[model samples]
Target: MLHYLLTLAIFFAFFAVEAWGLNLQFGLTGILDFTYITFVAIGAYFAGVAAMTPSTNGGMGGSYIFGWQLPFPLSPVIGGIAAAMLGVVVGIIGLRRLRSDYLAIVTVSVGQIVWMVIGNATPLFNGWDGIVGVPQPYNSVMNLSTNNYEWPFLGISVIVAAIIFWLVRSLTESPYGRILRAIREDENVAAALGKNVFRYRMSAFVIGAFIAGISGALQIEYIGAWNPSGWTTLETFIVWAAMLVGGRGNNRGMLLGAFLVPVLFTEATRWITIPAHPLLMEAIRGMAIGLLMVLAVRFRPQGVIPERKRVFPLTTIPGLKEDVANGHTAQG
Candidate 1:
C-alpha cells in the first residue's frame, strides 16, 4: 500500500508537468494542440530505446533502433529534443494562419497519422508492443530494493516537478508570457502591434512539446515501457480536462486539477463496487471523465481557480505618467 501511494504521488508530479505544458500552449498561447500526446509518445519511445540494448531485456523482449544506454538524464533530454523537433515541423505547417478550430482539426489528423504509423511500423517502436525495460535513472548505482528505490525516485519526481513548475511559472509571469496571453486573447491585436504571431506561437508549441516529452520520458522510466496504445488522443483530452478543471490560465490550478481528475478520479474508480463486467469498469472511468469535463465546462467554465486578472497601473512606472502627460500637452 505504501508503494502504491508512492506511485500515485509520482504520477501526480508527472501529470502536473503535462498539465503545465498544455496550459502554456492552449491556455497561454491559444494553441489548440490536439497532437500533444504524439509528442509525449515520441519522448517516451526515444527515452526507452536510449536506455535499453538492442537485445531483449527487462521482462519484455524487444529490439529498437537506438540502444545507447546513456546515463540518467541524457536519455530523457534526448527524448525532449526529439519531441521538440517534431513540434517544430508540426507548428510550421499548422500554426501558419489557421483559425483555432481548423488548427485543432489539423492537429487531430496529425495525431491519427502518427499513431497509425507507429502502430504499423514494426521496426519503429516494435509496432504495438513498444520498447520496454527502460532503466530507472541511477538505479545501478543506488542498488536498492524495489520498495526502497521508490523512496528516492519519489524525491526525484518532486524535484523534477519543481524545476518544471518554476520554469513555466517564471516564463508565464515574464513579459513574454504577457505577450502570449495577448495572443490568446486576440491574435489579430497582437499581430497589429508588430508581434510575429507565428513565431511566438511556434515557440510556445515547441517549448510545450519539449515539456511534454520530458514528462513522457519520466513516465516511461517509471512504467518500464512505451506503447502506442498508451498515448491515445484521449490522453491529450485528459490533460486538457486537468487544465480546464483546475483553471486554464492558472499554474496552481494545473496541479489542483491534476490531482482531482487524473489522480483522484482515476484511482478512485478502480475500487468502484460495480456489479458489471470488468471491462465495463474501464468504460465507466471514461464516462466519469467525460462527465467531469462536461460539468466543469457548463457550471464553472473558468475552473475552480480561475486565472487572476492582470492589471497594469500607469502610476507604477516611474515618470511614465508624466511623459504621457507631456506628450499629450505638446500634441494639444
Candidate 2:
C-alpha cells in the first residue's frame, strides 16, 4: 500500500506539471495547442537518448545520436532546451497568421508529422520501440534499496511540482499575464494597443513547452523507458480535458483536475469488470471521458474552480476621483 501510494504521488506530480503547462497555453494564452504532447515526446526522447549508452560503446543495439551517456540530471535540462527549440519552430510556422479552427488543425497536423517521423525513423531513438534503460538521478550516489530510492524520488517530484507551481503562478499574476489574458480575450484590441501579440503568444507557447518538456523528462526517468506508443495525440487531449474540468485559468483547479481526471478516473477504470472485448473497454473509457467533457461544457463551463476576477483600483488612473465627483465618466 505504501509503495502504491508513493507511485500515485509521483504520477500526480507529473500530471500537475503537465496540467500547469497546458493551463498556460490553453487557459491563460488561449493557444489551443492540440499537438502539445509532441513537445513532451521530444523531451522524453532527448533525455532518454542522452542518458542511454551508445551502441558504439558496446551498450545496446539501437542506432541513435549523441549517446553521450550523460548524467540523469543533465538529461531533463537538455531535453527541455530541445523541446523549447522545437516550440520556436512550431510557433513560427503555426502562429504566423492562423487562428481558431485553422490554427488547431495545423497544430494537430504538426503533431502527426512528428509522430510519424519518430515512429518510422529507426535511427532516431530506436523508432517505435523507443528508448529504454534510462538511469535515475543520483542512483549511484544514493546506493539505496529500490523502495527506499523511490521515496526520495517522490520527494524530488513533489519539490519540482511545487517550484513549477510557484513559477507559473508568478507568471500568471504579472503584467505579462494580464497581456496574455488581453490577447486571449481579443487579439485585435491587444494589437491595437501596441502590444506585440504574436511575440507574447509565442513566448507563452515556448514557456509552456519548456515546462512540458521538464515533465516529460521526469516521466521518462520515473518509468525508465519510453516508446512512441506512450505519446499519442490523445495524450494531449487527456491533459486538455483535465484543464477543462479543473477550471481553465485557475492553477489550483488545474492541479485538482489533474488528480481527478487522470489519476482517479483512470485508476477507477482499472477496477471495473467490463463484460466486453478489451477494445470495447477502451471505447467505453473514451466514451465516459467524452460524456464528462460534455457535462463540463454544458453545466460548468467555468470549471470546478472558476478564475477569480481581478479587481483594479479606482485610482488606477490619476485624477479619476475629481472626474467621478463631477459626475463625468472617463472615456477611453
Candidate 3:
C-alpha cells in the first residue's frame, strides 16, 4: 500500500507539471496550444536517447543518435532546451500569424506531423517501438532495491513539483504576468497600449514548452521508456480539461484539477466493471470526460477556484486622486 501511494505521488507530480505549463499557456496567455504534447514527446525522446547507452545491450536492438552515455540528470536539461527551440519555431510560425482557432488547427497538425515522423522514421529514436532502458539518476550511489528506490524518487518528484509550482505562481504574479492577462483579455487593447503582444505570447509559449519538456523527461525517467503511442494529440486536451475543471487562471486550482482528473478519475476507471470491449470502454471514458468538460464549462466556467483579482494601490500614482477630485468638483 505504501508503494502504491508512492507511485501515485509520482504521477501527481508529473500531472501537476503538465497542468501548470498548460495553465501558463492557455489559462494566462491564451495560446490555445494544441501541440503542447509534442514538446513532451520531444523531451521524453531526447532524454531517452541521451540516457541510453549506445551499445544495444538493453535497448532492444533500437538505434539512435546522441547516445553519449550522458548522466541521467543532464538528459532533462537537454530535453528542455530542445523543446524550447521547437516552441520558438512553432510560436513564430503559428502564433505570430494565425488567429486562435486556425493556430490551434495548425498546432494540431504539427503534433500529427511529429507523431507520424517519429513512428515511421526508424532511424530516429527507434521509430515506432521507441527507446527503452533509460537509466535512473544516482541509482548506483544508493544501490537500493527497486521498490525502495521509488520512495526517494517520490520525494524528488514532490520537490520538483513544489519548485515548479513556486516558479509558475511567481511568474503569474509578476508584471509580465499582468501583461499576459491583458493580452489574453484583449490583445487589441494591450497592443494599443504599446505592449508587444507577440513577444509576451511567444515568451509564455516557450516557457510553458520548457516546463512541459521537464515534466516529460521526469515521467520518462520514471517509466524507463519513450514511445510515440504515449503522446497523442488527445493527451493535450486531457491537461486542458484539468485546467478547465480546476480553474484555468488559478495555479492551485490547476493542481487540484490535475489530481482529480488525471490521477483520480483515470485510475478510478480501471476498477469500474465494464462489460463492453476494451476499445468501447475507452471510447465511453472519453465521452464521459467530454461531457464533464461541457458541464464544467456551462456551470463553473471560472473553475473551482476563480482567478484572484489584482488590486493596485490608488496612492501609487502621484496627483491621481487630486486630479480625480478636481474633475468631480468641476462636474458638480
Candidate 4:
C-alpha cells in the first residue's frame, strides 16, 4: 500500500508540471491550447527515440534519429526545444486571426493529424507499435541498474520537479508573466497599451509547449516507454481539469489540483463498494473529472487558491485610482 501511494504521488507530481504548463497557456493566457498534450507527446516521443536502445521489444519501434545516445538530462532538453520549435511552426499557421472556437477546432484538428502521422509513418516515428524499453536518466554512467536503486532516480525526479516549480513560480511573478495576463484579459486593450499581443501570446504558447515537453520527458523516463495510444486528446482535458480545480493562474494551485484530483481519487477508490471493472472505472473517472470541471467553473471560477491580487498604493493612481488603489478603493 505504501508503494502504491508512493507511485500515485510520483505520477500526480509528474502531471503537476503539465498542469503548470497548461495553466500558463490556457488558464493565464485565455487560450484553449487543447494541443497541450501533443507537446507532451512530442517530448515523450523525442525523449524515447533519442534515449532508447536500438533493440526490439514486443515488436515496438526504437529506431530513433539521434543514434548518439546522449545523456538523459541533455536528451529531455533536446525534446523540449523540439516541442517549442514545433509549437512555433504550428502557431504561425494556426494562430492567424480566427474566432476562439474556430481556433480550437483548427488546433485540435492539427493535433489529430499529428497523431495520425506518427501512427502511420514508421520511418518517421515507428508507427503504432511505439517505442519501448527506453533508457532512464543517468542509469548508464552512474553505474546503477534499473532493477535496483530506484530511489536514486526517483530522487532525481523530485529534484527536477522542484526546480521546474520554482522556475515557473518565478516566471509568473515576472513582468513577462504580467504581460501574459494583460493579453489574456483584453488583447485589444493590451495592444493599445503598447503591448505586442500576438508576440506575447506566441511566447507563452511556445514556452508552455517547452515545459510540457519536460513533463513528458520525465514521464517516459520513469516508465521506460512511449506509445501513441497513451497520449490521446482527452489527456489535455485531464490537465485542464487539474488547472481549474487547483486554481487557474496560481502555481501552487496547480500542484494542489494535481494532488486533489488524481492522487486523492486513487486513495478514495479504496472505499469503492462495487467490484472493479476496467471500462466502468474509466467511465466513472471521466464523469468525475467532468463534474469537477463544471462545479469549479460554475461555483468557484477563481479556484481553491485564488490568484493573489497586487495592491497598488494610493497617490499615483489613475483617475480616482487613488481611492481604488488604496484601502477604501472602489471602481475608477
Candidate 5:
C-alpha cells in the first residue's frame, strides 16, 4: 500500500510536468500543438534505449546501440535534447502554414505518424517490447536497499519540477513571452510590424517541446520503463482538459488542473462502484472529461482561477503589444 501511495505521488509529479510543458505551448502561445506527445515519446525512447543494458536492450541475446549504461540522471538530458531536435524539425514544416484548428490537425497527424513508426519499427525501437529495466534517478546516491525507493523518487521529482517551473516562469514573464502573445493574437499584424513572428513562434515551440521531453524522460525514470504506450495523443487531451478546467493562462490554474482533474479522477475510480460491466468506469470517466471540457468552454471559459490581465498605464514601450488575459489583442 505504501508503494502504491509513493507511485501515486510520482504520477502526480509526472502529470504536473507534462501540464507545465503543455501550458507553455497551448495555454500561453495558443498554438494547439496537438502533436506535443510525439516529443515526449521521442525523449522516452531515447532515454530508454540509452539506459538499457546490452544484454536486454536489443537483439535476441546481447546487442545494443551505443550502449553506455549511462546513469539515469543523464537520461533526461539526452531525452530532452532528442525531443527538442525532433521538435525543431517538426516546427519548421508545420508552423509554416496553419492556424489554431488547422494547426491541430497537422500536429495530430504528425503524432500519429510517430506512434505508428515507433509501434511498427522493430529494429529501431525493439518493436513493441520497448527497452525495459531503465534505472531510476539517483538510486545509487540514496543508497536505499528496497523496492520502496519511492521517497527519493518523490524528492527528485519535486526538484525537477521546481527547476522546470522556475525556468518556464522566467521565460513566460520575459520579453520573449510577450512576443509569443503578440503572435498568438494576430500573426498578420505582428508580421506587418516587422516582427519575426515565425522565428519567435518556432523558438517558443521548440522550448515547449523541450519541456515536454524533460517531463517524458522523468516519467520513464519513475516508471522504470519506457514503452510505446508511454505517450498517446489522447494523453495530451487529458492535460488540455486539466488546463481548461484550471485556467488556460494562469500558472496556479495549470498546476491545480493537472492535479485535480487527471490525477484526482484516476484516484476517484476506486470509489466508483458500478454494478455489472466493470469497464463502465473507464467509459464514464471519458464522458466526464468530455463533459468538463464542454462545460468549461461554454460556462466557465476563464477556468476556476481566471487569468489576471496585465494593465499598462499608458506606458507603451517599443514592441509592447496589448493583451487581455484570455484572447489575443495585439494591434498592427
Candidate 6:
C-alpha cells in the first residue's frame, strides 16, 4: 500500500511538470499544441537509448541506435534538448501564421506522422517492441532492492519537478510571460505595441517542449521502458484536460489540476477490481475522464483556480505622476 502511494506521488510530480508546460503553451501563449506528447516520446526514447549500452545481434533486448551509457542527469538533459530541437522545427513550420484551431490540426497531423514513423522505424527505437531495461539513476552505487531504490528515485523526481515548477512560475511572472499573455489575448494589439509575436510564441512553444521532454525522461526512467504506444494524441488531450480543470494561465492551477485529473481521477480508477475485459475497462476509464472534463467545462469554465489578472498602478509609469502634478497631459 505504501509503495502504491509512492507510485502515485511520483506520478503527481511528473504530471505537474507536463501540465505546467501545457499551461504555458495553451493557457498563456494561446498555442493549440496537440502534438505536445510527441516531444515527450522523443525525450523518453532518447533517455532510454542514452542510458542503455548499445544493443548487439545476440543481445536479449531490442536493438537501438544510440546507447551512450550516460549517467542519470546527462541523459535527461539530452532528452530535453532533443525535444526542444523538435519543437523548434515544428514551431517554425506551424507557428508562423497558423491560427489556433488550424495550428491544432497541424499539430495533430504532425503527431500522427511522427508516431507512424517511430512505430515503423525499427533501427531508431526498436519499432513496436520499444526499448527496455533502462537503468535507473544512481542504482549502481545505491545497490538497494527495487523497492528501496524507488524511495531515492522518488526524491529525485520531486526535486526535478520542484525545480521545473519554480522555473516555470518565475517565467510566467516575468515580463516575457506578460508579453506571451498579451499575445494570447490579442496578437494584433501586441504587435501594434511593438512586440514580436512570433518570437514570443516560438519561445513559449520551445520552452514548453523542453519541460515536456524533461517529464518524459523522468517517466521513462521510472518505468524503465518506452514505446510509441505509450505516447499518443490521447496523452495530449489528458494534459489539456488538466489545464482546463485546474485553470489555464495559472501555475498553481496546473499543479492542482495535475493532481486531481491524473492522480485522482485517472489513477483512482485502477483500484476498482472490475471483472471485465481489459479493453472494456480502458473504455470505462476514458469515459469517466471525459465526463469529468465536460462537467468542469459546463459548471466552472474558468477552472477551479482562475488565473488572476495582472494590474499595474498608473504611478508605476515613469514621469506619469510628475506630469499629472504639473497639470501637463500629453495628447496622442
Q: What is the TM-score of each candidate against the true structure?
A: 0.91, 0.90, 0.90, 0.87, 0.86, 0.92
Give lDDT per model, in order: 0.86, 0.84, 0.83, 0.78, 0.76, 0.88
Model 3, global lDDT: 0.83
Q: In lDDT terms, which candidate is top? A: 6
Q: After superposition, how far is residue 194 of candidate 4 from its true place, in Å?
A: 0.6
Q: What are the clashing pairs of model 6?
A: none
Q: Where is model 1 poorest over a 10-residue stretch in terms of lDDT?
A: 54-63
Residue-wise C-alpha lDDT for candidate 3, range 1-332, written one tens digit per residue:
78777887788889899999889999998888987889888888887788777846435567777786677668888887888888898888888763677678778888888899989987788888888878776676888887899988888788878988998999999998999999999999999999998899999999999889988989888888888878875677778788899899899998899888888876546656566665777677677778778988999999998888888765576767876656653453
How many clashes in each structure? 0, 0, 0, 0, 0, 0
The reply for model 4, stretches above 4 Å from the true place, is 55-63, 141-148, 266-276, 312-332
Candidate topping TM-score: 6
Angstrom error at residue 153, model 5: 0.9
What is the alpha-carbon lDDT for the whole of candidate 6? 0.88
Q: If the candidates were sorted by their lDDT against the true structure, best first, what order would they fall in?
A: 6, 1, 2, 3, 4, 5
In the range 1-332, model 1's lDDT, one tens digit per residue, is: 88888988999998999999999999899899988888888888888888876654333566567888988688889889999998998887788864787778878998899899888887767888887678888888989877888888888889889999998999899989999999998999999999889889999999999999999988998888888878886788788889899999899999999999888888645677567576788777777778888999999998999997878776687867886766653453
Candidate 4 weakest lDDT stretch, 10 residues? 55-64
Q: Per-prediction RMSD in angstroms?
A: 3.7, 3.3, 3.4, 4.0, 5.8, 3.2
Model 5, residue 240: distance off in Å is: 0.9
After superposing candidate 2, which stretches have Cα over 4 Å from the reference? 56-61, 271-276, 312-332
Rank candidates, TM-score, best first: 6, 1, 3, 2, 4, 5
Clashing pairs in 4: none
1-332 in candidate 2: lDDT tens per residue? Answer: 79777888888898889999989988998998998888988988888788777755334756777777788668888888888888998888888873755668878998899899988987887788777777777787888777888898998888888988998999999999999888899999999999999999999999999989989989988888888899876688778888899999889998999999878886546666666665677667677777888899899988999987888766677878777777676664
> With candidate 4 superimposed using the best TM-score fit, by how many Å does residue 315's alpha carbon deviate from the native?
13
Q: Put down candidate 4 lDDT per residue, 189-235, tens digits, no spaces.
A: 88888987778778788888998998888888888877788888667
- Weakest 10 consecutive residues of candidate 6 by summed lDDT: 323-332
Model 6, span 1-332: residue lDDT tens: 88888989999988999999889898899999988899888988898899888888336887898899999999999899989999998888889874777678878888999899888988888888888899989897888887787799899999999899998899999999999999999999999999999889899999999999999999999899998888876677778788899999999999899999888988766877557665777677777777777888899988999998888765788868977777676552
